[model samples]
Target: MGQRTLVVVPRPDGGFDCRYAHWGVTTDPFSGSRPLGRDWSGTAVCAELDAGYDRLLVAAARPRWYCVCWLDPTLTDPDDVVLARTDDPDRLRERWTEAKSRAVDAVARGTAPDAARAALLLGLARRADACHRADDASFLRDDG
Candidate 1:
């Protein structure tokens, strides 16, 4: 099966909006292959990068959703504090890719119990990073 990911976006009212992403774990959501039948994928997204980016971020603010790299869908979570931020998509992709590899390695080396749990938490933590950044970006837009 494809790397199944639970895409979570924190709602502004103190909750989360989530969906099951059947693909897009290690792949670029803006280029190459994408999840079959996903509305947020490939050329459709590339055609309107900024608008697409806005849509993805606004999921937490207004409603909607990818630059899988900046989207960094793999390594984000809502509670994370941004250590540093970069607007470069390539750099973000590298960061998330490294994180994903580490989790996969943990699954490989871990014993049965730890393996299963680690596997589950693999892409769970960093989702909030995306949400928070998105929220900030949205706020900036509203202000300006």
Candidate 2:
């Protein structure tokens, strides 16, 4: 069976929740059974990404909420913080495309997992950093 990344988000009460299946087998909502499916469509992935972004926006206002991508099941640490929150949906969509493209390219070129995963992880980190900087700049402007 092929491996898939599960997107995990923080719950309001505490603990984390796995929300999305990146690729491979996913539970069929109607039947409550796992279905064999390879290659999650880009649209579906983007939808999940959007949901994660929404959670980040909510977290920004509430401070206790957050979302993250769970790359390794054995560990609880988040591989990527889903902080690409933005008013423009298209921007987040573009980020999804870019990240996926980098991952696919790495796999195609036979890059090791360490290098391949880093490309996607770096993309996510950069997006989060950009959002943070924007938030910081806005706060400063408002305070000044």
Candidate 3:
């Protein structure tokens, strides 16, 4: 399977709206490329939501391999707007579980270029913290 990524954003309902990201999911995949996951960092995620993107689709257009980031189609390049659709919690959860397994396997193999990132994701997923809701005050504070 190709490297799949999910861009999960916060919903007022206390759940996340996970969207699928089609490219630039990982920089390690490209030789000589600098680490570029900053777009999915916690701060970035919060900033995107704070900018009023709640109306976008919350769930993935389809289940992807890895879950991370929040991409606003309006703020991104037209090429970056790959997929958009309604919510599907079951499928999203299934993908999350699958991605966690993939991460575990990738780490155990000890050969994947993204092994370190996989390990980090595995640790977070183990704690049920990968794509779950964030605490508004600490992690996803919205001062609006």
Q: Which pairs clash in the backbone of model 3?
A: 17-58
lDDT of 2 by residue, 45-123 (tens): 3334422233322212222222233222222233333334334434555565566666666667776656665565566
Candidates' lDDT values, in order?
Answer: 0.35, 0.37, 0.35
Error of 3 at 115 (Å): 4.6
Better of 2 and 3 by lDDT: 2
What TM-score, to 2 decimals, does candidate 1 have?
0.27
Question: Model 3 compared with the native: what TM-score?
Answer: 0.25
Give the per-residue lDDT of model 1 (tens digit) for 1-144. Answer: 343333334444533334444443333333323322233322232222321121232233432223332322233432322212223334554555566566545556753534533443344334323322332333312312
The C-alpha RMSD of each candidate to the native structure, in angstroms, is: 12.2, 12.6, 16.6
- The lowest-lDDT stretch of 10 consecutive residues in candidate 3 is 77-86
Error of 1 at 10 (Å): 22
Best-first order by lDDT: 2, 3, 1
The number of clashing residue pairs in model 2 is 0
Tell me, by TM-score, which candidate is best.
Answer: 2
Which candidate do you rate higher for TM-score, 1 or 2? 2
